[model samples]
Target: MTRAAVALIYRRTDNSGTQLLFIQRARREGDPWSGDMAFPGGRMQPEDASPRATAERETLEETGLDLGRHGRFRARLSDLITRHHSRWRPMVVTPYLYEWKGPKAVTLNHEVEHLVWVPLDFLAAEENQGRRPWRTPLGTLNMPCCRYQDYCIWGLSYSMVQELLAQGLP
Candidate 1:
């Protein structure tokens, strides 16, 4: 069966421009997606009332940011699914989006190794587009990606950003 997940998209405005929060997962031998840059989210729990609730809960668990208290949440963006080599059995994953209110620095849990607040304008730039050969245990091939300094946003994470772009930028 396909598993369900949700992510909280936190964005904020500054004199420079709007930025989005991204978390880098800590590398663990057992994690299929270890060390990947991703949004704050995870699989839905039985206790979660809805996809949005799952997103809110995971955001708090991963970043110590409570969307209900310190932030405003909008159920914007559409769901995205990807088949991944997860620890779980054969599955497709659904990711729902909840955008947080403002630019708040994050306090990450052990599950995260780093945090990146990517500028929206950087994502919209054509110069940032490129392809690179990425090797995973599964194999290697050139793939579409966006580079920002030491980070490369690709795979399903790239898909989500594409959706965000398609929705039109401010």
Candidate 2:
């Protein structure tokens, strides 16, 4: 099985609320997750010492956010498995949570088309949670997700949020 890692970066607001950072992947042909909302991450490279290291490196490479310089490791959410399908292979993904203490401005690389800081409160609200039908390589299916503005957080990203919420906010 393949393994990957992602950084779930968040920050505390002046009003005591928290916001989590997400990236909109740039569209590309043959990319299964193209144009989808996701965290800063990618498949583990040989140089990575651990999953945490992969998350840190990917965050910096994709967003120009130096987690090592401004992030505090908070928790490791549950590892999630991607569904096996004809167009995609199953993989395991480890998620590392980080509290960001740096500037709000981010320098995105080519992999990321846009970024959004979504409030924790907004995600936890029941009204904002629902299942949306998505057409995949298999067929159209109703998938659980959280909608924020024009982006929809689903699949592994959504599972990570659920795990984080279940573990209680830090």
Q: TM-scores, in order shown? A: 0.84, 0.93
Question: What 10-residue stretch in candidate 1 is worst by lDDT?
Answer: 86-95
- State the TM-score for model 1: 0.84
> Model 1: which residue pairs collide?
none
Q: Which 10 consecutive residues of model 2 have the lowest summed lDDT? A: 82-91
Model 1, which residues run further than 4 Å from truth? 87-99, 102-105, 135-139
State in Å the error of residue 116, model 1: 0.9
The most accurate candidate by TM-score is 2
Q: For residues 4-28, write the lDDT of model 2, one tens digit per residue.
A: 8999999999999999999999998
